[model samples]
Target: MLLFSRFAPNVLLSAAVALSVILAAVMLGLAMDQRWLGLKLEAQPRLAIPASFEGLWIDAIEHDSPAAEQPGAGIPASVASLVSIGGPDQRSIQLTPQDLMEEPDALETYAGMRAFFARQDEIAGILRSIGGVELGVAFLGETQTYSVSPKHQRPVTSLPPSFWMQIGVGLAGFWLGAWIWSLRRGEWATRFLLLAGAGLMISAFPAAVYSTRELALPGRLFSVLSTFNHIGALTFGVGMIGLFLVYPRRLVSPNWLAFPAVILGAWQVVDILQLADGPGLGFHLAVVLAMLAIVVLVAIQFKVTRGHPRDRAALAWLGLAVVVGAGAFVATVIAPNVLGIGAFVSQGEAFLFFLLVYVGVALGVARYRLFQLDEWAFRILFYVVGVLLLLVLDAILIVTIVDERAPAFALSLLIVALAWLPLRDMLARLVLRRAELSRGNLFRQVMDVALTPPGRDQQARWRALLENAFRPLSVTAAADVQDPALIDDGLALAVPGAGGLPGYRLDYADGGRKLFSLRDAELAVELTTMLANALESREAYEKGVAEERERIARDIHDNIGVQLMGALHSRGLARKDMMIRETLTDLRDIINNASNPDLSFDEMLADLRSQISEHLFAAGVKMKWEVESAGPAILPLAAAHTVRSVVREAVQNALKHGQPKSIRVTVRLDEDAIALTVADDGSGFDPSSVQTGNGLANMQARVTSLGGRFNVASGVEGTRIEARFPVDIVRITQ
Candidate 1:
């Protein structure tokens, strides 16, 4: 669980250290286990002394080693009928078919398995004293005897399964302990878990090496390893008891933990030194007491953590894991030895089974955030509640609806789906105070940030946008982050710089109500990406704006500036008037962005009319203006500018060409468009004879280009120019 959990970058702690330790432990075990692999053991006859012991069986020897040359060494199982070993200056032991079990079993009572290993020990001692793997055997009912030396060390190509199994358990146990320790360096429970794992490793690694020995090892070396194994096992038991005493609630002061340690340490010492009458029983009894102590302490924790649901939940799972794993080990392995009974499970194999405790602890911490495992576990927790709620509802409906399992269950399922699907999120949000990350909302906010003026203002908006999105308790500049990061086990979330804003780390999401989850880290990435896109767009827009401004500057200098210089040099008023008119005409070429423009139609019209009236009056023409409205008084800027150009050009035409006496300009505003008419009482030109100037053509082109119509009616009585233009270019209005 720790291994997989750490793989998720956003989930929780980084356990490189733990994983390193596990690897180191595995390598160490492999090296130590490889030390004793001097024979091809498992594939050979392997001393297959069946529990029924049916006279010692042997396989046909293939090589002429010392043991292979013995008389009975080549005999098959059927030919052996081996009964006893009473050779001169060698082992004197009796063997029969109905044998005592030397294996660990799932069903064996504790008392049935105690003497089994001690007897094996006695046999092992005799073999160690035999100088070599030479055993004398006397066949039953035959009075013939033979001796074979079996210990021929060879090039072993493989290590046994039990060796690897023990190594695997050791690695996992140490990894779990280290993983928890990394989550919080100083928690008491975490320390206990590590202690437990250390003990298991100490015992398991040695056992992996010694238990898989092909034959007997040096008696002294064997004794030392055995003593160390006991020390590790007892230490493990004591560690578990200490863990329960402190976790979920403290049963005793942490300082007082030394007392149990000292007591168990002394018991272990006594067992090793053989000060007690039965060393095996003393060791077993110490383990049993520790297991019992764990049970009692777990009960106390369950009771003490009652008011806190989270604590209770954590304790409940951890408690169950501890109880089941430790209880199984005690009942199957230690209890039987203590009771002097036959153990169904072999001691070495039972050591492997004991590893389940660490596995369970890892799972408990991973699933429920026990021992500071962090908040990602809560997502799973909510789903767990949903499952439990569904079961409960199903049961209630089944009982109440009576004999209608199908429909009742279906209804229950539907109800739970509806209720919990939303309620689970609601509860999580309530508990965690998480924000909903809406893409639409995010888009708008990013656009607003993009609209901010680039540089410091835009950068500020970028920062504000992140703050608004996450609502963290605090935000600080984090320059080192080059990408999004959920760091300090999700205590802070960091996002890289975007849109001229510096990178930042946000701490304690939702005012410390919750840790940032993997989902939050993902959101940070998305937000950063969006901000980057927006910033690119803004940069593009600003570039276009800069080019447009430069072009305008050139236009002013080349057109208006040159004309003004000429006007300054000119001495005549008529020449200056003509120059001003030429300047206004040149101004028409200035670009106007017409897409999606909006303004008050009435205001634009009134301002244009005022300018036209003043110009016409100054030109000595009587001016009468009228405007009609159809409401929804807004129009595009392009339309307004077009109207202004037409009005100005028409007045110049009537005054300069036709020599009008009076001019009438009328504008009509409608919901979708505006219409303009300019009439002058003057000498109208003949249609076929008189040629119009650039003024009328420009007006006609401008009006028609915007999907509008233009017409000129000229007669001897007067001339009238009329044009209609769409007010909205892209459906925007006030």
Candidate 2:
């Protein structure tokens, strides 16, 4: 029900109504038949004297037969006078043997004549004397005798069961199609349903014309029905054409065709009304014009599908329907009338055209996504043929069973059952296999790898697995080598035997490899390079740890040495005991703070400053400090300590030899670089003369090794030292 509502509500309603009407019609027909049966006892054969047969032969012929002297016996002059031929108001008519010379015309006229005689046999004597065949003749003087065959039976004119069935089917089909159309709102569905309904109404018009003459409908009703039919046909044509334009797969101009379509539709309706009484030249003209429009539409459809391959299948289906429908329409209109095959055949042909059109339209609208229509068609054909074969077999079985050949029927059934399952399975498997193949091999391989577990030593394992897997493709791969080493060694070795031809190498190893022509050699080189790098890195890490430990020991011994010795010197006396204890505490604190990894570079610098100030105050050297930084002070603790040591050494040098009155230390950051300068106003010495004795060379060497610039400019006025390093370098070391 939902499906019907969704896709074809109009169709559903039409089918329902058609079914009800069919049931009513069937019941009514049955009741009529029963009533007819009940009236059989009193019923007599109905016959009529044709009004046209009055004066032709009845006037001249006499008695029931022609006389010897006359070819047709003349009517008795007295009786003819009394009869007044065809009564006073009737026009005189004549019959001649010339009219009866043609067998077909004579037979038709004779049949009418016989019907007249049967209804009024009392006047048969006059009719026989005129044109009808005589049953007997009286002899008087020169008498003649004649005989006649019994009259042909008139055919029963009631509608056949098949005719009713056809009407029902057509009504149901049209209603179903209309209901489908009605699911859509407003003009679109209404117009289509109107068109379909008009077609059905038009179809019933001929039956109504055939069935009744006295109760003929008013001319206006017929005119309106005709107009509606013409309009509906026009609407259908225009709608289909509009659909072609609006939803085309390529360029289309609906506006270009719309005005003309409307004009053509109106013109067609006028033409139909004008020609409704009989076939006219105007009807032919309208048909020609409609054909031209159909041609133009088809041409446009072809143009739309030219560049759009996606629409090709749909266009093909539509084109086929159009061709078939048009052919059928043409055949229906011309074949029976021109060839004399009768009317029902033409109607059947028209019905076929309509059916084809419905199927095509339904497929185009609802099943267009099935682009493989040809495949579907083939499958349907195959199944239909298969089913037909099964039916044939089933029929044979039934016939055989009825004839007592049970073994034959059983054998046939067995054969069919045995074949069906395997055949269906084979077809399914073939389709699936083709689909799988179309997806490509590489995708399958990737899927396989994804579904598998990672191995221990996953990197090497995966590389080896890929290499082995790809071996079937003649691809040689190295899994664990660096690129440069592959270029330097692997390529040279791999290419020597191949006369210097280069080869391609895929680099899947840790650091990858250079291209190699020979796959085997590249794999070996890659693996070797990976192992070498790994071992080298491990060794370097171990060496760095040992060096760090030694450096820490050296720093501890150097910084704390003088303070420890001073404490040891004062250990024996009570007067020096307090000094010794204080010295020991300071030394221990410095050592412990220096060893702490978590201490930030700025905190270390502050500690260093405090230690230096304590030492300087103890030594009686006045210190002036100035520090300016643009951003954070981010020097590492180790580098900060080194800077402090350098500062202390400079101050000590100034105090010991230069007799400096005031010592100054300034730290400033400029851009990313830091500059630290220590200067004193004291008796200064020439830096060239001081040489390495002043530890200037040591300070310069320490700064140079750390990628910093250190300079000591000492003259007679004062000694100045400046050291500069990158903040990034300091942080990295920390």
Candidate 3:
């Protein structure tokens, strides 16, 4: 029941439409058969008065009859001779004057005349052969003339070509009508296809009937059918013209469509009225004009919409349909009349070519998206050119060397293998570069970015890559985002930011020359998802690193720092107490606060001095601090740790190992780097005898890691250590 409700109305309407098409086809067939019917009737036998038949005989005269042998002596030649008639059944007959009075049946009269001729020939032959008796031919003046009439039976096999033509026309109409009915309402192209289909179907009926009119349909039916035939012809031409005008694109006003109907109707009326003396040139002129108009309109459509992928695809298919369908018509129907040669194919077969147009249109109506029609069109173009080249070369080969079709085709194949096949791919690539290649490489690039990670400069890099991909006039973040997926805002694509994704607005794509298609839209969505995934991955990675660093910092401060504090409290000896203090300060600075960068210059210096003084004062060594005009400057966590570690190591080595009398420390800031110098004047020692220890090695490594310079000069005179760190590392504020 549900199915019935959904489909019943359409089924009923389609049935009605099909019935109408069949009726029109039948009518058109009958109409076009009028002339053939007239010729057939005139050829059929009819009775005539014997006076009108005058000197003519009505039967086949026997040559061996005594009357014929004696010529004028036996019987009148006019009475003895007969007339020959040809029709469905061929016959030679004679009629007596009494036949006219009886008004005999044509077939029966012809049969009687035939038997009389045979009997006379038999009697005369017997008499002549016997050589004893003779027979005289008597002259009975025949007042009735008999003509042979055979039963007119038209079997399907023997039906004329026009009958098949009507069938094809009717079938084509149904195909297109069903196609139109299937389409969405209000489609202009649907209307065009229906009009053309209707015209073709309507015109075919009378034509079919006319071709087979020998079956004896009434004469008045022919007159009525003929009138409709002209009307159908005009309608077909108008429909064809209208189709060309509206399809693939609409290039004209709807009002202009009425002109074809009006003009064609006027011409048909003129021809029907027989107002002019010459043949119906006006109807022919109108058709020719419609064809010329079609050519102009097609050119305009191609001109206006060229280079657009969708339009180009539609045009390509439409052109193919025209070439296949129209080419058949011209070759079969038009060329025969124009060149005075037999048709290449029968008109019935020619009608089948018109289905190519319907197929093309069906593809168009389906939107042809699934086919990737742009690439197919390019392939077709290359194929056509290649085939044409092969044909030309083959023709030359046939003329110049190979005179046979087999050899020419073989050589053409070889040429195609060597040249056209390879060249065609290259040509297609050149022509379809933008259509086939642009989006392809872009997706690969997007995938690469997704698989790999773009770092801190990801935004800029992504922008450049996108610019190269789409060749957009501009790409910017949308000020207002409506949808986070992929927004097509007519002029651009707005890909919104989500999670860690950076949003982008691509404006005026392809340098503002072309609009994006559904394929492009889909690609945009994929690319956006890739970009978002890439960004999210980077953000997650950074978040994980930060969390891990914080965890490590807490572990160091809680566990290790407690151990150093305990040691400081337990020890009372100067060196042990100072060692514990320095260790705790180093641990806090290096591990607990290594990732922190908020400390000011004053606080950093104060802590450094306190640690040094505590250690030096315990060792009975003086510590001098010369801190210079260091303003409100600060250091990055890594740089601060490096500086503190280097300075502390230098002072501890001098106080504990070098036994220095005093240590002088000077800190100064330059525009680009901070310079820290520590010098010790103590017991002289030979530097060459001493090998590097872990403390000295560690200080050098720390300074180098911070992208700074570390210098140590040690001799008998004492050691001086200098370290300079770049301002960038510490992020010093003036």
Candidate 4:
């Protein structure tokens, strides 16, 4: 029970850690997938409008019409008061009779008879009425008589409250969704989405308040809405500027474009302050300037998208949005006021156009991915919206077309909506399937080499993969075996067979041409050395086995021969037995130690000391010993074994080579380091002309491998051999 209790916490912690790691991996994979899709989508087409609208005009008012005489029948106060009277060549006159009265007699007649032009649609009505008159209207200084007949214009319908409410909710939902997505990554696109949404909300305020039924707080609401609208306009301008800076090729800097917009926006605020009594000329000028600025901006946008083929589709969609938005705004607001159109149609058309324009702008900025899904989505949106619009407009058109009833238009709209979805879906499926097939085929060819073994046949496969992987970028891979001459053809990828087998190289290119190669010459040399060592080890192992069998046979023969010779010479049995026992014991010990390599250094040292003590006691010589080391005495097994062997050999040499009378062995740590010293009082020889035997050479080699320094000094006073290995290098933890 206690064991289970103690282990449960650790088990739970381990599980938690594993779960966290798995979650992180899944999240990372999802992020990578999204990034991959984004890149693929970026390469697709864009939509935009062409740059042309140089000659267009709309009439504002028809003074000869009965609608103008009716109370509340003239154009909306906002539209009537702001329209310009003169053409671009002449200084613009206000929409007042006083300005016309000051003109010359010939000019006054023309000016008095001229229809006020606001939008393109208004021109038709004025031209119809003035067909018999000799006077002409001047547009950009060109005078021309009306060409179109007068027809009774129709009224525009208002959108339902429910539909607008739904639009508002959808916009709010989109913003919330975007904000949630941004909480994780906060990318530039996400920030742009949030900013655009906020601007839309601010811009919607004045329109919303103006439509409300409540009148008590109308003045306060208007003031608040105007402030918000002005601020929102400024923010939108700044956001566009930022967007251009970030994507300079896609969007031009609005430095020149924004100046006129800002000035006009300020003028609007001043005009609002003066209410209906604002300076008429100043007000009309501001409106004209604002329209011109918008036109210029749209033209610039068209140019940018046209020059870049990759941006064509996205720019196309965006361009449609701008055109529809701007067209709607101009047709409703400017056309009716300039050209003397009927008030009922003018106000209603203006609102409807404004709504359509708003939708276009929203889609352009926030829903770029809709374009990648195929043009079908746009076709669906356009036809569906357009058909419903036509039905609503059919009632107005019927008065001119054939005097149709309102019920027929509503029935047409219902039929169009029902047919739109199926057609859109079928088209989308056909387009997407073709796209998917091409993408899949390209992916398969590039990855096929990774599944196959790499050899001569695979070499071509790898080259194919490389070429396709960097498609539109030319690359060639030459094998060292077949194309040795081409190996150094600028790209230095080492030829595989340049030296021998089992070697390869890589080459990198800048653009389509070879830049440099990375060769594994050092790796090739190391592999060759390893092969040589393996061959040598096998040869030595075979020789060692054969020599061992021969040695065993020789020992058996020598023992038998010695026994026979001893019997003939009558040698002593006891001495022969002792010699045999000693030889056998030495053989057994050597075989046992070779098999058991983990023998401790301290144990070996103790054994050596015991042997030395026994021999010295027998020789009637006294020996002194001293030893010291830090902490618990521990040394690496290899170092310890080597040191012990050298010390024994030195002691034997002292007894046999120098004939020492007494020996003093000191093994103590020097300060914070390990030190071992062996000294003996013996017959010392000359310092020079001493030969180093095979045994001495073998001892030096062993110590050298262990990175220890060995020193031997000989003199008349005494002979000394010192071996020292750094304690720091030799010590090991228990």
Candidate 5:
């Protein structure tokens, strides 16, 4: 009782300890039985005659006491059934012997069986009350006297295979039943399974003792043991019926479970009192009915539990248990005997069939989690650790003993690297259900999330990365976890905040297929570290760019703006003239693009026309400039800089080389592109024959960098250059 009641807190440890106790009990029973029958005769004297014949023919010449030292009482396989015994001159257990054929009347057909089994108890009582040195034996047509005194004493190893096998059945049932009960102590199904196990042991244990007797046990002890065996059979049926009534789906209230036990107990009473006229009503009827009931209940459970996958799986396992557990016993033992056809094996050996049931159920409950999956997967990880130790041992052995072993280390590592590593990953994915993103892929994604700039959109991108990696069913904001952790038995994983990103709680991993394991937690830690580092690096880069931009703005104020402010004191047109010139120069410097520029295309064109007019007048060259455009008003710094620099260089080239009388600069703007044409009336040279200068190369490079076109044509009339820039393409590059 202490063994059962004290150990519910630690399920696995309790099961192992209780199972060991059951094994020890069975071994002790075997030892006691082997020593109980002290028979050292050369051959066994157990007689198994056909059930049809009934007589005891004991031929004895020396009539004092049976001796192991004398001669052997060679009992043949073919012998008359033993049915009569008496006191020393008083006939006490004599019975009529005949061969009765089967008949249509069921009661008449089994009348001899009923009479023999009913009076067999009384006959055993008579034999048990025998006095010292006195016994009697008789047959139908003859008389003889005999006794069995195994005074030479049996060897310690005198037990038969039937005894060991019977003990196995009992221990198997008892241990497996205790194991299931240990795991699910509060479950009604497991409790009934435990009861079934107790019943199996009760029947098998006592049958192990008397059924393997050398010659005979005392009649009273034999009768009590036989009654105990009947009790086990009765209880076993009741447990099965009650188990099916509630398991997978409860077909009846748990309160109604006692009715089957009460009914079966009453039926056992009738069998014991010989109230039933037919012989099959004793224990076999209960067994057959329980089996039929299990079948019917399984069918009903299948229909009722249609949408429940877990319950259906349990039902399949339990139904298989019934078929394997009780089916063989009926086939070989009870069914044969009830039909007046002799049993194929001894009743003790037939108990082995009952062992199969508990083994199947134990595998279902303990190893498979009712046959769903993912238990051995956890324990096998320890085995993988042991294998790692073995690999380390191999490396150490190679270093110490082998002459040429440097290459062997590589081979060993490669073997595990290619084979064991992948297998381990596959199992981790199957059982642990961690994210399968590769390290390289995850690093790239985390970098993208970090570079998304600081705002709500950046945080959203970070959250999106987590969703893609883990594929959790639901995500919600959570209080900050200092580190990523699995909570609620892996039902939810709490991810820590990294950089500016907030913590999140992820639930029901992989569509609720599995729980998070250490593998998943380790993966989360890796991702957190990566994201933190990437975000820190992006923040540092952006900070450096801002600091540099601040210095440039300061330089503009000190070196350029101060001189222009000094000239602002002049009056009238001169003051305003100086101011406009300072503004045009500052706007060109700003187009160096330290940060994004937001200047309109009209301001850019105004600056360009001013520069052209001033530069042409200084060169003593007449100018003709016109602007015709339709496009977005604001252009980014890069696109505006390209427009400014390209036009400035083209005008300088015509003034230096073309020696033009007059220059015409034409600009046309569209939504996606800007087109410019610079042509001069001068002594033009052949463009193909002349060496290209830095100015022409720079203008062409700027135009083509924005995915536009550049062209040049030269003749005696003048030199013409056309360049076009895709303004939208320039903005996308930024």
Candidate 6:
């Protein structure tokens, strides 16, 4: 337990910690999701005039006579109202529901309202030809109710793609942060990155609610969203700046971080006090200045780490991240707002740009080990440029020949195959003139080190191999690397030692044009791993010689030494010859066991019984051997050897020291443990009376070393020595 505790905490804890912080940020920004801003306006039902039916009428009536002689005077006055006198008796009038319903107060009930317009079409047609002159007729019904009020425009309630994009980007930032944190093994720089991601996600709430510009958001809510957005912007800027300052190189003191905080806070103060012509513009300017500072910091890092390819590469990657992420946001969001120009793309599209920054940063730190900077950078440039070209071409086609999507997509793909591929390849060749080593070839080179002769300078050879594969400016041994480390971003990869071998530091100085990227770092790691294996092999070879010598010395001292000592003090040649033969047999057993260590309990006990029973029989002592194991218990080579030796020594003691007439050896398994006992019908001596000797101490040490108990319980009736050892069933099986 103590040994396990010595290692660093689990990597999963990074994700757990990051998730807690992000979720807290989410809850803090929850009101934004509830549409506290004026960005969300709801539509209410209202009456509207129907312009389509405005001037058109069913029929016109010409009634030149006075009201007493008007046409259809036979009908009720309310129905007759559909005909009316106009201009003079010679003129035609278009009297419809509009005229009748105009005097709604004249009718008392809902039925009268319905009846007024019911026969307007027929009444108007009947009255149309009454006058000599014909007039156009029309019926204007009551105003119609529409779902939306024409007086107020409302944002669509259904989720828009832009809103979803904001949501996805926000959530993606948080999840990506957690994932990066988990993978980073708790690097402090990654922690800042995680914070940046959380802030981005929190700010997404406001972005989502305000995606549609036409929405009429509430004033107070808008102010709150604006504040939240500024906070998010500040957080992201701080994170990015901190990452630049500390990562790849810690050029500035941590105290420099306070500058952005104070600046942003002051800007926020101005915004809150409404001191600026544009309320949020000051905060945005502060954020922009902070971002510009980050760029300068990265450039400074690049300059400082000029000769260090890995660090330079990391700074270079950060530069790209900033340009792609911040540039996209500026072009899409900030510039339009500042210039009062329409945005070409929605702010949601900026999420992709943000993702690019994260991906670039991740590559700079984690991926640098995997790829060669030159080749990887060339490929990325080619692919991105080609894709952009294709998009431009497709867009051209959209505005020209192809107005629909399907045909445009097909044509774009066709153009990509014919033009993009050729262009990308040409660009790649122009940029990356040198050919890279294939993965398989590199692996083979690493493998060849193992086959090198022992006398050769394997360490130097491995170093040379890495130098060639990675093209590092310098390679030196670092305090035996135990794991892969990113030194100055991807400028150097510190590979830990393998199998107790010394580790090496890889340094790359490729000038300013090229820096070690993720792909390069990955290949370096492979080479380092290969080097580690070679070192371990050399270490194992040297250690094996020492271990073998120790084993021989211990074996001689324990078994042969004691047997020879006993023979020297014995009385007869027969006993001496017997001891010598036993010694020879023990020597053979040691050699055999050395080659095959996994000796099971049942097999070792059977051999122990065989060897001891013969010795007891020769000594004119009856031998009763009883061995039982509940399951196939496999003991380690050393443990099995100790068990056999302890049992053998006990039987010998009973016959040689106690002069026992009969001996009984018993072995049994109990649950996850095993027990061994030797009993004899001999006169027993008090253990306290006998002084502790090398043989007795050795036996006790062996049992105790295996985490087992060893004891001798003796009485006059019989003497018994017992040893018990624990076994892990699952561990043995595995």
- Report the lDDT tens digits of candidate 2 across residue range 601-714: 556557657766765676577888877765444565445655766776677678777887778998775656667899988888866676563457656765676688998888
Q: Candidate 1 lDDT, tens digit per residue, 181-229?
A: 6556567777788888878877777676566654434444555666677
Lowest summed-lDDT stretch of 10 residues in model 2?
Answer: 34-43
Model 1: per-residue Cα lDDT at residue 113: 26
Off by over 4 Å in 4: 1-203, 215-255, 262-604, 610-632, 636-642, 659-666, 669-671, 679-684, 691-718, 722-726, 729-734
Give candidate 4's root-mean-square deviation (CA, Å). 23.9
Task: Score every model by TM-score.
Answer: 0.49, 0.31, 0.43, 0.32, 0.46, 0.44
Candidate 3 per-residue C-alpha lDDT over 663-693 given as tens digits, one digit per residue, 9 for 90 to 100: 9999886666778999998654555566665
The 10 consecutive residues of candidate 6 with the worst lDDT sum are 36-45
- TM-score, cand. 3: 0.43
Provide backbone clash counts, one per model: 18, 19, 25, 38, 0, 33
TM-score of 5: 0.46
Error of 3 at 23 (Å): 4.8
Per-residue alpha-carbon lDDT of model 4 for 570-612, expressed as tens digits? 4666546644543454344345444553544456557657756
**Residues 1-734 of candidate 5: C-alpha lDDT, one tens digit per residue:** 45666554344434443554465465445335321213222111244642333443222222222332333452222232334455444645554332111111123224554443445445434444435112333234334444533223333345668777877787668666655565566777777887888788887777876666544444455556656777887778777777888886888886798988888899878766657765476656766666677677778888888876456656777767776678788777777756766667667667877877876675554322452223443344324433554466466668666456666666666766677777766764564433457878888889988888778988898888888777788889876678889885465788886886888998766654444545567788988999999888988998978965764674455435653664575465654675467555755566445655556778778877876787687568998887776544777665776677677667767877879989988888776777889898877776666556456766776678778899988888988889887776423211
Q: After superposing candidate 5, which stretches have Cα over 4 Å from the reference? A: 1-149, 152-156, 371-734
For candidate 5, the 10 contiguous residues with the lowest summed lDDT are 97-106
Off by over 4 Å in 6: 1-384, 388-405, 414-430, 438-459, 472-522, 529-549, 564-573, 631-635, 728-734
For residue 190, give model 3's deviation from the true position in Å. Answer: 3.5
Q: In model 5, what is the error at residue 169, expressed in angstroms? A: 2.1
> lDDT score, residue 309, model 6?
57
- Write the number of the candidate with greater lDDT, choosing between 3 and 5: 5
Better of 2 and 5 by lDDT: 5
Question: Please, what are the lDDT tens digits per residue for candidate 6 over residues 1-734?
Answer: 24323443333433344454455445334423321111111122122542333322222121321222324422122111122323224443344333422112123332442344343333333333332222232224442211111112222333446666666667656655544554453464666677788778766656665443322234344446556766776777777777676777776676775666676667767755646655225555666677678778777888888776555566667678777787687667665545644445656676667777766654554334312223444344344446555766787799789999889978998999998898777655554434567878776766666545544355565666766766667778988566777676455667665443457777763433344555556666676677567657766987887986776677778898888887888799988888888888788778877887677666677777778977987899998878775566677676677777788778877876788889888887776777889999999878887777745677888788778999998899879999998764412442
Best-to-worst ranking by TM-score: 1, 5, 6, 3, 4, 2
Candidate with best TM-score: 1
